[model samples]
Target: MSKVPRVGIGVIIKMGRKVLLLKRKGAHGEGTWAFFGGHLKFNESLEEGAKREVEEETGVLIKNIRAATFTNDIFPKEKKHYITLFVIADFAGGTLPIKEPQYVEKLEWFMWGKFPKPLFTPVANLIKKGFNPFKV
Candidate 1:
């Protein structure tokens, strides 16, 4: 079997001590609440892809992105896997999109200790580890 490495990006944007979250609409981790992000395209660097995704999905421009955390999702029994890089950044754009394709059901900031349970797997673990990218 061959192992596939997928590069993705997530942001931890804080507003007055609150973090942003979006409810997934479709695809992996659908129906769960997670950070705003997506897969990296062929010609894009991780940071570039991260910035693009964050803006495209939320219409929010991320500035001063800092490495946060790395996560590995491996389902050996089922031969499924994913490696994700999480980055923390500051949100500096107008209000978020309230539509499909980018169909984030809801957007809200929440206190760290009061975040909801059953968060998207990668995100939940990253948050649990305190968002340190190089740790992985």
Candidate 2:
């Protein structure tokens, strides 16, 4: 079988002391809480993809992105995906609708210790490590 490569972007958005979390819908981690992100489009750079996804999924424009985490998940029986994750801060943009309806079922800000359970694996891993959702 031939191998296929996939690239994805994830962003950590912060508002003061709280971090934003989105509830995903109809995708790999559907119904799970996660950061704002999505797959990269053709010829798009990682940073570009991340910026676009953050806005598309959360309606937030990320101003500062620091390279902090990288994850590669490979499935021998399926496909391999390379993910570029960033810790974003100091953003300025319009307030997102209470809910994004299609991509996200809900959007909420939570303090690390107070975040809800069952976050998508990647985000959960970060939170578990006490990774400052804001700091890179």
Candidate 3:
């Protein structure tokens, strides 16, 4: 494992009381539910990274993007660590997320208190921290 940890950005796109979740297949959090996001590219602003990731992964757009919360995640089994920055935004409009057959099993909307089981560890950590994306 590298001595340095990576930085990941997760975009929490909230619509009404729902949030978007992608079922991961062949990634670190395989077989778990996670937000649509990836690592922050070099020299990219947080907001830029968030917008870029969402578009790249889902081909969807968002508006009123804003910083939300973060989590410090460590996965000993995978021998990885990440400083997870989360941002909340509203779905702007465009093509909805693709199923991403290669890695994503499904793209689904879930109510705030009705997240699917076996959440990605990072996302589960957020809930453990008492995170409520709907908070002002």
Candidate 4:
């Protein structure tokens, strides 16, 4: 049987003109910049999962969470598929720290239209579709 697609939530915490991004350093999407996020926990709502992921990964609290867009991410080489929900939110509080060094290399703020390359597949796909969280 083929593996099923997992559900994920990507949080874009906006601070004025910039959004938070992290360089991934794990099995999937290594060397690519991505928004803070992770797999959704069972029975967790999308908003809850987004908040949890952002806080867990970057130690940043977010609020005013809203659904921005989504993408169907399929990594055939990795044998992984995911339906990722993209959320736009405001940075509420908390210090930004590299909480999970195992999965992330570094965190930085990038202007919306000036993102660094190479971006994670899902984020790149979203950008290609003209999905702008800031405009939502």
lDDT of 4 by residue, 14-47 (tens): 9998999999997599999999889999999889
Residue 101 displacement (Å), model 1 = 5.2
**TM-score for each of the candidates:** 0.81, 0.78, 0.94, 0.95
Error of 3 at 51 (Å): 1.1
- Tens-digit lDDT track of model 1 for 1-136: 2467666677777665677888887666777788877787888777787787777776676777777668876545546566777777777777777534545778888776567766887777676667633233
The lDDT values for all models are 0.71, 0.68, 0.88, 0.88
Candidate 4 stretches greater than 4 Å from native: none
- Screening candidate 2 with a backbone cut-off below 3 angstroms (N, C-alpha, C), the clashing residue pairs are none
Q: Report the error of model 4 at residue 101, Å.
A: 0.5
The sequence of per-residue lDDT tens digits that candidate 2 reaches over residues 7-82 is 6667777778887888888666778888787787989776787777776665576777666675554434434454
Q: Indicate the TM-score of model 1.
A: 0.81
Instruction: State the lDDT at 37 in candidate 4.
Output: 88
- Using lDDT, give the best candidate's number: 4
lDDT of 3 by residue, 1-136 (tens): 6589899999899878899999988888899999988899999998999898888777778999899889988999899999999999898877775736677888888998699899998899999999998876
- lDDT for model 1, on a 0 to 1 scale? 0.71
Q: lDDT for model 2, on a 0 to 1 scale?
A: 0.68
